[model samples]
Target chain A: MDDAPNSEHFTLSPIGHMVSDYPDKFGIPRQPGLAPAANAKLVLAAPYNDPLAVRGLEDFSHLWLSFIFHQSPQRWSPLVRPPRLGGNKKVGVFASRSTHRPNRLGLSLVRLVGIDTQQGVVLALQGCDLVSGTPVVDIKPYLPWAESQPDAKAGFAPQTPSLLAVSFHPAALDTLTQRSDSATLHALIEQVLSQDPRPAYKQKELASKRLYGVRLRDVDVKFRQRQQGEATTLEVMAIEPYDER
Target chain B: MDDAPNSEHFTLSPIGHMVSDYPDKFGIPRQPGLAPAANAKLVLAAPYNDPLAVRGLEDFSHLWLSFIFHQSPQRWSPLVRPPRLGGNKKVGVFASRSTHRPNRLGLSLVRLVGIDTQQGVVLALQGCDLVSGTPVVDIKPYLPWAESQPDAKAGFAPQTPSLLAVSFHPAALDTLTQRSDSATLHALIEQVLSQDPRPAYKQKELASKRLYGVRLRDVDVKFRQRQQGEATTLEVMAIEPYDER
Candidate 1:
């Protein structure tokens, strides 16, 4: 093996950052493609914003984004408790896609809805789970022949995430009617609530009257989950403009 | 929306390097899983070599490897000529999966064969395209539910690689009969040659009698391509131990 010097470390400067719908880590979905309506805009920085840098990128329908988990803790552990495993069982950090690892690298596959160059190079993306201001390191077009693996075994996480039923209150429905792009934001709220975005312990509590606030776009969505015997449903109480207090 | 400071720069150090069958960059497949017989061993460096760090990873059948193109030049271009496109027409660097880009990051999907830690943390991988001593920055298990996309539209690279016919010379066949793992090596040589591992311009030459050499393992594999009428065939001339001078 070739043991040469200067190969030990590598530096990656952000080519761009995402202005996604996700405001914080509290309500963001764990993985992409679950919420297809959660769209984001990727804005390229400084010299990289040259239109020539993404000349033929429009031809690609999907792309792979290599990004940094900027919000994860700097200290890492050898083992991690995956939320999918009920956040109890321990598995090697590599076995689970945990952000707190030796490296804070994150990989995601996003559908390219459209590419715009009005002000700078801005890309409209769908099915993204990254938060706003997430630093993107590299972007590559997805090769179907080389990457598609439908029959692969998924060890622990076998099934797709189960969805919960969601309903809107009279006040929340009124808020949607007054908005111009209410149809888009309405779908985003329904999809985000369907994933049951709550801690394992909170999800297990029977009929706990905890009103959770999820920030979607510029509104603070206040909702609560109710359990009637074996069935559970999330109902939105109100939707108001977020106040940074 | 977020103008956070210290979020633009990221640093990644090598967790380990691969000791693969490919000795140099001359004959390695452009994409992984091209040559199933081609195997490699990834030896983890200290601190990352802890056995607990890889626990439960055996359950997953495949993994994603994030590596650096250390052998490539530090300079990059916005446009690239892909060999898949006959190396004539140029495409934006982002449209193609060329190693030369804004960042030197390379992503590959490989099947995890086995993991051994008798001496250190050595992982046996199948269907890799990386050369020996290739530095790896991160490893993550493949999530079938989140990452699988068989219906994706590939803009340029739409089809799987087409392979050519490969034959062994009398001396080359004789050399295989004397080796212990000839079956494995024989299949690797045939699969490698089937891809027509020659420059696009060289493949168009009028049956030029130029002999080519590819180093596989510790041997120098001498081969040539023969053209007749409209059919082309590659033949192995000899398999001899390579000498470094």
Candidate 2:
């Protein structure tokens, strides 16, 4: 274009950091709302924590969070294979919501529960698929009138990913029964496993099953696939404290 | 909170920029899709323009552009008066989608028409409410199933903005007849004027009607409020060449 801006780039400071249910990227859902048990909150710092900055925010039920893929490698690739496409066919980074893209920027639509201003600006959120400690740059109320479109065409990823049946092994069930927060942990584990957290390549090789573990909260959840007749169930083998080093 | 990432900030480079029907910010719609005639395109540069970067993008009907509000002032205010709230009540910057936010970052959802690879990657888009020369940092295909929620609650802005009735003066109609692209210009003008481009404060002071001009393309569109009893119509008084200096 003849009138493009001369300044090619700019810098921004993180307004705060996230505290989410997913401890790492390994098991996080590919998209928000895929795991409703995945709760989160943004803990503001320094100049951004003023209560007045969040005044009248409760009226909005959802918000758009602009965040950074801080954990992804800084180097970016033009084309990437999305897990939704079976991690086989290559698509542009922009075509697929891959973390390996220019600028490493990301967007997540999360439900707004409420705000806690006792210690500072702590925004309680739900259905966020981000890893804990991710950097958040900006937050904007979701304008449903302008944003919501039921008839939109979503190419390769047409619908929510199909779920895999989940069950617990005897030892894992025994461990859950001993914990006070068993219900919460159980629900979180069910939500995480149903989405099948295995790498895309492994997801295809269902016949040769193996153990896979992902850190959720403070426990490492180990699970493997069990096929019986026509149905396949992802059975949780064990849940051990992550500090067992 | 104990696991918050220590890294506080980062920098980014603009992968592309915008060329749109909106020449300036004064008359631009507050949100995307408010004015469908507000067409636009993104001109990508350098490594970002590789055709491989946009492969498989054609399948998706819409995209989200994360851009910098380069035209807005660098400084930010904690409180802002949104036109939706009658411009009297103040809300926190985050609570409202005002241009003067902390990072000056904005998100726009635009319909993708197609891509042009004659020179570099040029994205043809529609329903964009951003000004020309916008610095776009990232582009992601819109996933409707997760994002579309008609039931979500919107605080201040609950619906599409109401528009005033529009009509053209005799002189303005005469000018339109001489233009080769009269149909395109006519549709653009009607879409813009009906939204009532006057500042929020002036919108309420309807009785003291006066002339207002906004630059669209290479023409200066002059208009004013006309209250005919219970009906209030915005009348276009003139359409003169933009370079009248």
Candidate 3:
């Protein structure tokens, strides 16, 4: 028998790369801007390094990011169960935000913090859920006038996410105090863990584990998952910024 | 050896069917809303017949329609040349609106003319570029407050399409006059032909006697291509409604 034919291929050059504190996907928020204090940086590629590219961008409080899901495997399926739908009901992949798609492109709206053009081009952004080292395909300044709709229907994910009440362990708090920017680090950690970023089904299995630690933005986030009747709770243990060895 | 695996083993039950005056693909505006007078109808499926599902739709003047490119062949390439980009420069299939896709789903924004709950939950739409039998998967009301961005940057395709000047033959005008709704029919015919729907690089052979005809809505348009000074021109010969035998 003859060898099977290989599918066609193409190369995509990233316009920029994302640098965030979250090195792995395990604890990253499901959607960008879900954790407001989670900051990330954008390092522009050559030829795109012109400061003029970012001119008039600072006026906008937020920006839209177009990026590739470079890590997702190539195989695809027609249907995918969305985590937002409790991961039980099956829906067409095109109707849901599943990483397994015909094309692995992803679009996310992120908050723009600050831009620095002095050394190449670095954009400081907050609430960036992208994993560290993720390649950004394109970035455009967001027009709030055209994008904000208070009355628009959100379909199944209509309910706004609830704010979680959290408390930190005294020891974990001590580790954070040793950092120069302890307040900022503490706030960032609290914001992320409070959202209960774990996969929905995973909650039942991890119920007995009192302390959960996640390393993000060069900090170790220790938290405890508790249950008060029907309500699920997450208590922050401590946020300690890593020390360079 | 075992029987070869079947590559084409799938059936799609259309969630709903689209009925547009654009009986054929040729000369339909490349983008919807370009021809305001053009209208179409959508008929939903059995289980989706509840009128209550459309309760909050009246507030929006437009909508996002997710549909399948049922006419396109099932297989696809990784890259495709977009007709909007002059059909020479190749872009990833995901980036172009080319029908050949891993999953042949299409997204179009169309103007909502009106909704009729009394008659089988039908929705009348204007400026729809979809063909008559296109299958619609889902419909979401367009929130202009969150969607319209005059300042937002568009890649490849500019916000407004370039327009071309057109002239029709007297014979074609005479034929159109004999129709019951001649005035409306002529206006619709002129709007469609002016868009220059011919494929790029289609003039490969110079067969002087050949005439091309495009069927639209309730009319048949016959035209001949000719050179006039520095520009190519289409000389219309006749416009008649399709006579079903």
Candidate 4:
């Protein structure tokens, strides 16, 4: 294999694109399954349109999505600094789930809500971590019996996220109230922004910015940033639903 | 990134070599952590032997080994047929844990029993699944709290393996009985071989072979193939301890 060094390249075409309410990368949970109400729709491509391909899928409550981080434009390094580890300690790229790699593949387990085959093929998913319009290569049904091992230990991320008392500004709540499924959308926005998604190093720049907004599906979510020493405080600004051109 | 397609290529060097009892790949488990007692040692290269590099390593009981599969001489395909899935159902290479990948980098979590820094760093590990002389590019301590998700679901693999009664021929037992800690070695051999490590398609040629031997550590394990109607069996032949020339 080492004799011919140039003979190992391969390519892949995305089978579909994931359309999620998440329009930006910053506020999406660092991990999937953290927000169960964040909805996304996977629109499948043609020739792979066979409805039979999705048979026995309804039995699974979640799926493993194999995807590519097509946007990352960097070469892989043997070692990487993970954000979860404070981005100072260097760990092997394989050990950390870094987007940069020899191959840019990313795997995330997301909740499967339902499937629609009427117009074409669409898989409704929740707790999606991908940005809107991210390409999806493949999906496999999650097998609970084989996948779950209750005895396994987790290292740095041992603490389950402490539930916070979330509140929204009156203006932001009014703006969200005008949308369909306003309650669901409000909960998602609150849950995501509350996690303090800014890079750890950017904590200072974020503190002074009073109004920060993220464009989501038909909505421009605006929020205010507050700093309590090292931790961040977020107050909702307003939600502007999408307006057609 | 698209403008400079050829500029993305990079090279890696082996930081160390893996020395395992299993000299060949024929009977090795498809994945590590399957057989916990199989041991191996890693010999580290110079320059990386600065005692400071291995600081804080003894805290973990296992490590994540990043290595290359230097044997298989084939280009990768987008899809591969996994032997565990009967080799009939084709799954994307990314979805299945197949060795044939665009880049043949392999990752295994092995039990780290000891780390000797005094003499050119030696890592004694258990549950090693690599073939003898495999080139290891990097090693990082496995943080169980971050890496292990007992609640996570596996995709297609069944939760529990079916029961099978395993026994060795009297002659084979006699040969193994001569070794120190023969009980552990016997159990390791039985557990590994019983998994039927042969390729799914090799049944036709394998059926006629009466005797097969695997060399590991200082022993040559010889066994005979038995078939009862549809069921297959492995009868032990002889265990010849290695004699260094």
Q: Pick the candidate with the highest lDDT.
A: 2
lDDT of 1 at A45: 78
Write one digit per residue (lDDT tens) for candidate 1, span B63-157.
99999888988677878888888888788777778888776889999999998978768889999989888889889988878888888888878
TM-score of only chain B in every candidate structure: 0.95, 0.94, 0.86, 0.87
Query: How much DockQ does model 4 earn?
Result: 0.15
Model 1 residue B98 lDDT score: 86
Which parts of model 4 are misplaced by more than 4 Å? Answer: A1-17, A41-66, A73-82, A85-95, A100-105, A114-124, A133-153, A202-209, A226-232, A241-245, B1-25, B40-156, B174-185, B198-220, B225-233, B240-245
Please state the CAPRI-style docking class of candidate 3. Answer: incorrect
Better of 2 and 3 by lDDT: 2
Q: What is the interface RMSD of each candidate, in Å?
A: 2.0, 1.8, 11.7, 6.7
DockQ of each: 0.65, 0.70, 0.07, 0.15
Per-candidate Cα RMSD to the true structure, in Å, reads: 2.2, 2.0, 10.6, 6.2
Put the candidates in lDDT order, highest first: 2, 1, 4, 3
Model 4's lDDT to the true fold? 0.65
Chain A TM-score values, per prediction: 0.94, 0.95, 0.85, 0.87
- TM per prediction: 0.95, 0.96, 0.56, 0.68
Poorest 10 consecutive residues of model 3 chain B by lDDT? Answer: B1-10
Native A-B interface contacts kept, per candidate:
0.67, 0.75, 0.03, 0.08
lDDT for model 3 comes to 0.64
Predicted candidate 3 versus true structure: per-residue lDDT over B151-203, tens digit per residue:
54434653456655556788887887777777776767667767666676564
Better lDDT candidate (1, 4): 1
In terms of DockQ, the best-performing candidate is 2
